[model samples]
Target: MTGEEFQNRLNAAFVFEGANYGRVHLIHGTQDAYSQEVLQFSGHLALSDAFKAVFLEAVELMNTYCRPRVKAPLSEHYPQFLARLANAFHTLCGAECAAIRGYPRPAFTTLRNVFDDVVLVSASLQKVTDFYKIEGIDPNGKFDPAAAKKARKDEEFKVRKLMTGSDSGLSADVTSELSKLNDLFDFEVHGGRLSLTDAMAFMKGTGPLHVLPKFVPQTFAVFMNRFTEVGWAVHRLVPAIQPPGVSMPKEWADRWTLVDESFEIAVRSLSNELGMKVGDAYAEFIKVKFPFNAGAVFPL
Candidate 1:
């Protein structure tokens, strides 16, 4: 769909939310706000209507197929639920789209990597919780049941400390870096959830590739490489904004670096193998337009 037509559709979709009309109108007026440049620079090539349809369908299928396999309650298994959805999205899309034949392997690999990361992180957190349960040591080095109850409130803190030694004064820097790396694979933060119409607008920005019947591995590779770079950049920059004295465990730090290095190598190899030019195009576009939307575009 043409940009203008897509914008109208989006505006219409937001009509039910009376408060969103003015913002929607402004978004409609600013072509650049919903332009191809935004999509390319943001490494958001997967934001197409076709992708969304396939993704939602896959999510439904996963809910039907994988939900039963999960032993935990739905709330507790949210991350697994999402991992399954992502897996289903990749599997169904790959099967339905002929173009995926060329890119299927890498694309499938990427999805698997993301799924594994989620599972790994979740498992790590669970292990830490189990360790605390068995050892009965809280962050303050105390063993009070009341404190333990309160500690559960900030579950992420416990997990973060265990994974990165946030309390030990060793793994702070490394933890920060790993956090940045994690963002690269996180879609909710990077791709901000959208209403169906807005999602369509974002997808339209991907141009003709979205409508294709097959996967474009090269395009996916280009987008992922940029996304990964942005994550690293955020990690490097955060220390400047907030002086770092946090500590991480040596083993965890080394393993984190190894993972980061592997991703870096994979990104470079994929770029060369796919002959992706999206990164260059994105760089050029950002050089010219970043100044105008500096606040909206860049955040560490």
Candidate 2:
């Protein structure tokens, strides 16, 4: 087929999906569909926006304070950690974009990447000695292939081992739960049978299968809540990883405080609206997510 023929055929397919299967095509109906979805769940939409703001603020704090001006011997590895943290924020931005555009399956898949990023960060922080070990450099600036291979292997952060090993400093119970969570993320990322079925726009009995994106309010709510929880856990670890002799600025600290307080309020309100019976809902969420350091707060 010619290029124009292929394009016309694809557009016809999209139009058919919208008319028959209730699918929102990317180029045509997604914006109107998303606008209606947001209106239908304004409270959850606001909470998603709040989570994005918090994640953005956390990235700004890292760019301003955690990123180094001059590379020092003691801070040589700061860039490695900061890069992963920044990447987590960027990936989350992508997830939010996908979600708001009515592509929740990919949004959920993007979140798995963010989860691994945070896990890697947590393991690095816990096993600081392994992370800070410096390698010998050649004075002649010659690279040794054997030494480089060894260095790469040594720097590997195996998620399963790190989360479950004794060196990770996590309790056995927490590690067990994390292992299950890891498996769940893997299933989502790998497109398991259940994941595929859930992505289809089905109702109580029977319906046409939708190939294009459609808004799933319950899935959106669940993913948004998980995103906020992960953001909260990662942000709380930032102060502990600040450069030696450097503290978080008072203005940024205060901003974090304001955001944290507001987030707690929003989380509690949302949880109650969603019929959660847990009292002190935000604190409970923190405890469940990061039981190893449930009491920790951001900005030190």
Candidate 3:
């Protein structure tokens, strides 16, 4: 092959068709930039669809509860806190979509972004820092790095400090989880030697490097688990914004219980019966495991 032909072939998008013949198909001369094939591969998975449904339901709950109509005469800080919480939920959904599409790196990075967004919401609630103050700008409406630098110097504004410090309002379990997740996601996002080597290892024996989406059930499972946890974290913020001793309305709370129970069953089913079809048996597992009647009213 000529030099141009060799380079063109080298840069083409290739996917391993099967392990039996070790065939790599170059479906197109250019890259599969949109990950169309990847999505197609993922679309057939029952567990993946369940994960998507769970996340969508969580986002729906957020839309239902985290709004002005839920509580009239909102507190002064409620708007800012809810805004940051909304951002976290938005990024959480983005991470879910990225993972569902078989883009693990983007999903990992965006999960870290979700954590940071949640931290900021917590910080605002704890009164460690004001959102507007940190976002302050010059009169011209342009960024002021100097002022930003000063804001960064504040001990209260440091992520680790805000998460772990005595004044941080987060519970011990939450503080520890956030701290651990931050490190884990940061390591993956930085794409260091270890991270790159690990990625390559995952693709080993699968022909050439996979530039397109891969249908890795294990990785998708992990994403679903993490998204479920993060969704709960987002939900917790709603009650945090309420008045002392105030909780979400019983109707909304009951609805959330249903979603949470369904999600847990889905995750457990995926774990116990990995590679099993998500059909009647899957629905049966949920019914059997949930300990509630389908026709019964929501449990008090």
Best by lDDT: 2
- List model 3 lDDT by residue over 1-300, tens digit each: 999998667555443453322343332322253345445444234433443454455445446654434544556565666567667767776776666555656676677667556655555555556555545433346677887667555533564464543344545544554455556666777864323644675567645565656556455545555565455445445445443333445655565556545555554454466753332232332232222321222111
lDDT of each: 0.37, 0.57, 0.51
Question: Taking the tens digit of each residue's C-alpha lDDT, what string does model 2 give over 1-300?
Answer: 999998877777665544633353444576567756757767556655665665566566656865554243444456666667677767877877777777666677778777655655565555532333223234356778788557544554443354544454556654555555557567777855435677355643457666555666776766666566556655555544455555456666665555555556655665467665322444453444333321232211
TM-score of 2: 0.63
lDDT, candidate 1, equals 0.37
Candidates ranked by TM-score: 2, 3, 1
**Candidate 2: RMSD to truth:** 6.8
Better of 1 and 3 by lDDT: 3
TM-score of each: 0.29, 0.63, 0.55
Q: Which one wins on TM-score?
A: 2
Better-scoring candidate (TM-score), 1 or 2? 2
Q: How close is candidate 1 to the true structure, as a TM-score?
A: 0.29
What lDDT score is found at residue 248 in candidate 2? 53
